[model samples]
Target: MLSRSTGRTRHVLTISTLGLTVALALSAALGGPAAQGRAPAAADAGWSSASPFAAAGSELSGTVTVPARRGRDTVVKLWLSNARLTSVPDACRSTVTVRERASSVSADGRALTCLVRSTGSRRTISLDALVDGEPGQQVDVTVMVDGRATPLGARLVTPGVPVPQPDLRLLSSPDFLNADVGDLVRGPGFWRPGRTANSTNADYRRALDTILDDWRAERPESVLVAGDLVEGWWGTEVDRSGNFGPDRTLAQRKAALRRAAATYYPQWKERFAERGLEVHAAMGDHEFGDNPWRAEKRRLAPLFEKEFTKRFGRRADGSPRYADRPRGSKHELSAYAWRPRPDVQVLTLNVFDATAGGMRIRLDRPQLRWVERVLREARQDGVRWVVAQGHTPIVGPVRSHGSSKLTYEGGAHSPLWRLFKRYGVDLYLSGEVHDVTAVHRDGILQVSHGGLFAFGLTNYLLVDVYEDRMELDLRDYATHWRDAPDGTRLWETRPQGMPKHLQVSPTPFTIGTAVVDGEGHLLDRSGILEQYTG
Candidate 1:
């Protein structure tokens, strides 16, 4: 039951009862430094086109078009309905191929990599190609599937335009428990004996793969994850004890955390790398043990945070993982900032500060000072957009489901938000709510979204950053799940066990969309987010 309101008519197609598809026709404008104010020639009218591909005995039918067009690279995206693939095949194995007809145009030297993934009954194909031609020249592109040629689309190269900067397509989702107990159970045999095989079911994997495939099709420059990358019970043995007895020494507990980190971190990162994605992740409460931080759990928080830093905050040589971090700060690795584009700065905050008082869901003094410095520097550097992400929301009365409902210590009037208001940070992204809520205050927009994937409430946000404006699209997919059997423990923290099986709808449609100008002004808003704009 995923839906959207775009303020314009949209066509929804139900493909073979597998999923829903929304057809959108958008025009492409000339981009790049030189093309800043130049009008796109009429020949670019078909820079993007969605044409149906129906072949005999073909299980796939949907739109094929060039969704992204950079200076010399064009990304063609193919959406197929009711198509199921046995495995996620490389782009070379895909039946889809792109051919360009222009004298000066030739393929870029890089090898062509395509990602073909099947989720539920839907399938997605993404192909990247270098289309080199003179500016203003019309390049006719055709997509061939199984040797059947279809007029996929055409685009015009702008004259005198310098090589375009990398496209600014960013995809984000939080509370993504990419790990399954089944994955851990298959690893180093650390669990207690006689444990059943609790790996993720095939259906769940398929749904996840499909979602990843869609992300690939979008051709994002980077992916941001707010936190909860795994169902981390790490050092604790609440559900299934390790080979050692339940009452272990401090050293034994530390060793357990290392083993768990070694097993899960690589796999979690591989999911993004294999799809050719660059990800910037923040640490969630799950990284240091789930919420309700009792005395014993609090004692192990530092150990857990160390392991997390070793994996995410540092590189192989023990240097910091992120180049742009809060210098001289204690939480430098956990809290960092980077500029994906010259005009945009993105910062990831580690809000879980394990103080002597308890686990305080607030940025410590060092990190808070660092945040203000970064924002001040961004303003001085003329950065157009500043987006900050943490694990929990700072504004409230938000919805929650299957979560601890942890918010920042002081809500909207907190020091963290006060700094944001002073510096004019455009957006704040957070998760841990297991639901979606949008709040706008003091010229800043806070979006709390992302769901427990196992529970079938998952969603993702796509931000398209342009020269003068940014578009945010919040999309949700329908999912179905049933109760898992007893002893199905994904981790020790969750009282409710993981779902036995989960299936996601093939179609993921937009639930909300918004537009903002360079000055942090809300230019337009629609769908579910419209009500929150005031």
Candidate 2:
């Protein structure tokens, strides 16, 4: 259902290209407005010949048509032009805007950006109208020119049939591991795994097992792991040089880290692969280095970038698959999107963008603005839920694992957080908070969980998204683990408890019971209901 627009088209005679010519040409050629490409069904939606609209110097009216498919969201595309159409015209002299009839979803501002490829290029602008359709109804679309309120009339033909249910049932939340996903050998014979990184592969492995075991029953199609694939945090290191001085120099350390990453990353991929789960990982704090590594990050940062780009697939230039970056930015793979359901989108961010705000974790302007644009486009696409995941928590108790200051929150004050709240994001997922709890903010919820040091306890959140509200099942596993003199840690079932620091929450009721806008926050404490206390 698209929102209704009114009025008649009366185009302005004088074309205003005062300072827009160069920018318009460059942006179009570089694919800014059309970067995403033509809609899947653009060709199927034909357009009528353009004719001069009444009371306009160069306004040519056109009609857009599409096969009406019932219950489905129909997107119609049309080539816009300012002059009379000699052929299937799409180019226009000034800006063009399209609006549709009223519906459940609508785009804000809803203006289309028109552009030219070269200085005097002749290609027309492609504008798309995504209509939220109703059965047996035709959506009237109005195309306005040069900031005109009234539209040169166009119509949308839809099947108006109800769309089938999006065959989506599961979206897993296993926060993966910290600085390392494997056992870290330390000390003379090796102290091992939980000494400094704050976590062990034992806990991660045990958590993975429990998560997969639940997966056997839940069978999630896509698993959304919240970063920290393997611990290369604090850069890479080698066994101390002979008697315990730093073994590798900065250059050597980075190389060693890259080499380790080349090997360990594939191993990490195998663990998730063996479980047969499609994983979408976000960049976490540990993925770069230890907390406060912001200062020294540049020394070993490229090692992380190389591994990340290699794994996630990116151009050699090191930009993301789908984002525009700011000047002087590295354009790394810190932010990306995953669409699990037709109406739901998962937007992930790397809160450790050091492009600004020295040493503090912030989204920065480029990424922040990119997120705002993405959310805006998502609204135009009729996406119902936008679940944003990042490394640090925007709002939470800074107790053991969370950002300690406002600069890190990315909440109301930060442009990124304000954008999220403004766009009405349903859920904001984060890590760094070892505890598996959900916090309610202005209108959204921040939920996080990860395995604590060793195999003491791990929290995996299972979000079940429905058409109306999202529900969550927080799984806590208190693993049985022991360390051998050989330094290999093992998981057992008789440990029965963890140290005070690694203890799981005692209050099961509020552990993962969260709702958003009286929406997703409603959850039953499964541990209590099943009478399985950790």
Best candidate (score: TM-score): 1
TM-score of each: 0.67, 0.54
Question: Which pairs of residues have clashing backbones in candidate 1?
Answer: 91-114, 136-157, 182-198, 182-199
lDDT of 1 by residue, 1-534 (tens): 111112322212121111111334223322221223443222211212353222221122123322222333322222221211111112222110112211010111112123223232334432222223455454333332222222322334343323233248788898886344346554553664465444455776687788888788868888899988877776675634553223376666667667777777776777778999888899998887787788777888888778888878898899988887877765778888999989999999999988777899998888898899899999999998889999999996677787888899999889999999999998899999887777878889888888787767777878777776677767766577776565464443344557677777665655455666667777445444554422
Global CA lDDT computed for model 1? 0.61
Predicted structure with the largest lDDT when compared to the true one: 1
Task: Report the error of model 1 at residue 88, Å.
Answer: 32
Candidate 1 — which residues are off by over 4 angstroms?
A: 1-167, 178-182, 243-247, 484-495, 532-534
Stretches of candidate 2 off by over 4 Å are 1-167, 170-174, 182-210, 234-247, 313-329, 355-358, 398-410, 485-511, 515-534
Scanning candidate 1 in windows of ten residues, the lowest lDDT window is: 101-110
Error of 2 at 195 (Å): 18
